[model samples]
Target: MNAIEVENLRKEFKSYSSRSGLVGAFRDLFTRNYKIIRAVNDISFTVKQGEMVGYIGENGAGKSTTIKMLTGILTPTSGKVIVNGMNPHKEREAFVRTIGVVFGQRSQLWWDIAVQESFRLLKKVYRVSDKDYNEHMNHVIETLDIGPLLDKPVRKLSLGQRMRCELAAALIHNPPLLFLDEPTIGLDVLVKLKIRQFLKEINEKYNTTILLTTHDISDIEALCERVIMLDEGKIIYDGSLQKLKETWGEGKQIQFTFVSEMSLDTLKELTDGLQVTWKQGEQANVWTAHAPSALLPEVISRVVNRYSIQDLNINEISTEEIIRNIYEEGVVHG
Candidate 1:
């Protein structure tokens, strides 16, 4: 069964076209002009049960808007949104119970309450049984390492501490679906790593369906196998992450440090017919080459056999680079 089913879903908002200057300001006081903005254009997609899908796009690209619709926070202007076999907006109370949402910039925990107190409140709100709550809470606290944070007030905890608690709060009900919006935002590498690891473990252990929306490319790369890329409120690309990489990520930047200084002409002759382009570095012994990924083995083998290399560095196409290419140049190459 599909965890999420959205068909031609769209959201629109109105923005005031306020004019400048004294006369315009006086006119605007009496009358205001509005322009319609389609935050989410007609788009359609589905996520299978227990699947982890990345919903990615730049700011104002309707990522949050779509999430709002799915979570029943906002009503869609048109089209259909069904999450976990029920209409989110229509069946809000029951729908919310089946899903856990974490917004990185927002807090679901009460500001003045202790983290443990907040968890209890959530358990009460969700009506989780004592046995079930105890089991889940123990696992969550241990896995997220939030035992030290349980007694502290939500506002007193550090951002990382609070975020860890946030995950615990969301999972208190043991919901089948999880919606994460930049859960790792503003976190240091260590915190991000912990969050990613926790997410992976829960998804695997419980078969939880996850819809992760993030600008942190590493988060998507680490947790998601498929991505639904949005641009200007449109679904630009939706498919396997590996396929996206292979299709747009063939170029590689390889750097080599030779044992001895090699002249540019000698370097050129050595790499001839290898479909590689040479770029000189500041130091004569160090050189860089841009080549297709397919030719990496041939380039490395040829250079390794012929020359004594001190060091070699290979830089693969980053997820950011791939997405940037799709944005700058449309998905289809002519």
Candidate 2:
């Protein structure tokens, strides 16, 4: 089953302006000057049931706009959105009950209320029965390790603590679809790991369909097998994560620190005719090279034979760098 189906989706906002003067102000009452800003252009995609897909883009790429339309917070100017077999905007009251949303910087909990109180309010709002509520609530508290925070006021919790509680609250009703926007933003390493693990387990155990949007590349790398990248309100790439890496990120970067400095020219002589590009690092003793992964053995062997290496490190081209390049170079696909 398809969890979400969007076709020719487009959203536009009007920007109106007028001259600053008494005459202009009077004229503005009768006449309007405005331009249409297309936040989300004609884009289409489908998310399968139980699939965890990453929706990623740079700022101003319309990620938030699309999400707003999906959750029924904003109406689309054109096209269609069907989530869980219903229109989000048309079937809002019933639609909201089937989905859960979590924003990293925005808290759904009441600030002055105790965490447990807030959860109780949500339980009543969602009409979750006592039997299922207790079963799920206990499971979430144990999984997130937020049992001790139940009595504390929302204002008293740290960012990590609040986020854990947020996840638990979102799951109180056991919604089938989950939307997470930067759920790991501003979180510590240990907290991020725990949240990622929790998400994975939930998806596996209950077949929850998740649509995750985040600027943190590590989160996407860890959680998503497929990614939909939007640029200028259009879908630039939508495919497997591994295929993306293999296609655009074919080389490995090797950083070497030698006991003695080696000029780029001399290093070129050592690895003569090999397709290695060497660049100097900020530190004089360190140098970095980019070469095909298949040629790494030859490149490293040649360098090791000539220099007394202090340290050597091999790293794949990061997803962050790859996405930046795509943005700058305007790489587009159909």
Candidate 3:
């Protein structure tokens, strides 16, 4: 059975048009001047058990709206949202026990309490027995390396420390499904790496079904194999991450260094057949093109044989580049 299922799920909000002045502002309160904004339109997808899927989109593209609806924070304006065979909003209390959620920008922990206190509260909220809670809590603490921050109040802890606590808090219940939204938003590199590694281990060990929503492409690349891309509240693409690359990411960003000097004319000649778009530099050229990494060896061979090639480096097309092109050009072209 699917772990989560959404059928033509949609969410609409009102963009209220306010008046300019005090009198107008007061009058506008009663005036129904607004436009219907479809934050999520015809969004539908299913996640299999133990699958780590990336739910990605730019800001205001309804990624958060879709997650809100899924987690029962907001009732959908229309359509169905079912998680683990139950309605998330209608069966909130029970439904929550089956899932764990961490919103990086928002804290579920109480500000006045110590980080450990927040975990205790979650344990109580979930009615976790002492033995089960202790087992899971200890495991999470070790996995996330949050033992040091346990006594610090939620407000006093650094952003990274608190985020670690937040992650531990979410997993205290040992929920089978997890939702992480920008979990590495402001973390430093080391922290992000640790978090990524911990998450990968948890997923592999427990078969935790995770839906990660992140603008950080590295998170998607490291954690997810499938992606459900959103555009203006619509499902723009949904498939294997590899296929997304093959379909619209058949481009390489190449950097070339010359033993001597080389001009754009020389670059043009060397990469004549390659669909190249030069970015910058002359003696050292950085260019982007609709050529995959597979084409790099030949390009390198050709340039080396003709020009005084000193050094050459090829970067595979990034997830950001592919998604950016999809958003900007409004189409995914090969």
- Top candidate, metric TM-score: 2
Clashing pairs in 2: none
The parts of candidate 2 lying over 4 Å away from their true place are: 18-32, 256-289, 294-312
lDDT digits (tens) for residues 1-334 of candidate 2: 9999999999999999996899999999999889999999999999999999999999999998999999999999999999999999999999999999998889999999999999999999999999999988898999999989999999999999999999999999999999998899999999999999999999999999999999999999999999999998999999988888887778998999999877988988988898887878988889988799899999999989878999999999888877876787787755
TM-score for each candidate, following the candidate numbering: 0.84, 0.86, 0.85
lDDT at residue 235 of model 3 (Cα atoms) = 88
Q: Rate the local accuracy (lDDT) of all candidates.
A: 0.91, 0.93, 0.85
Q: TM-score for candidate 2, please give it.
A: 0.86
Instruction: State the weakest 10-residue window (summed lDDT) of model 2.
Output: 325-334
Query: Which pairs clash in the backbone of model 1?
Result: none
List the RMSD of every prediction in angstroms.
Answer: 4.7, 3.6, 3.6
lDDT, candidate 3, 1-334, per-residue tens? 7989999998888898877889988898788588999999987789999999999998998988888888999999999888988899889899999999999999999999888888888888999999998877788899888898888888898888888888888898888999999999999989999899989988998999999999999899999999999988898899999999888887687777766665667677778887665554543444333466677777777777886655667777778888987898798322
lDDT of 1 by residue, 1-334 (tens): 9999999999999999988899999999999999999999999999999999999988888999999999999999999998999999999889999999999999999999899999888899999999999888899899999998888899899899999998889999999999999898899999999999999999999999999999999999999999999988899889999989888888897999999997878878988988887777899899987789899999988889999999999998688978876886677422
Ranking of predictions according to lDDT: 2, 1, 3
Candidate closer to the true structure by TM-score (higher is better), 1 or 2: 2
Worst lDDT run of 10 residues, candidate 1, spans 325-334
What's model 3's lDDT at 248?
85
Alpha carbon deviation, residue 208, candidate 1 (Å): 0.4
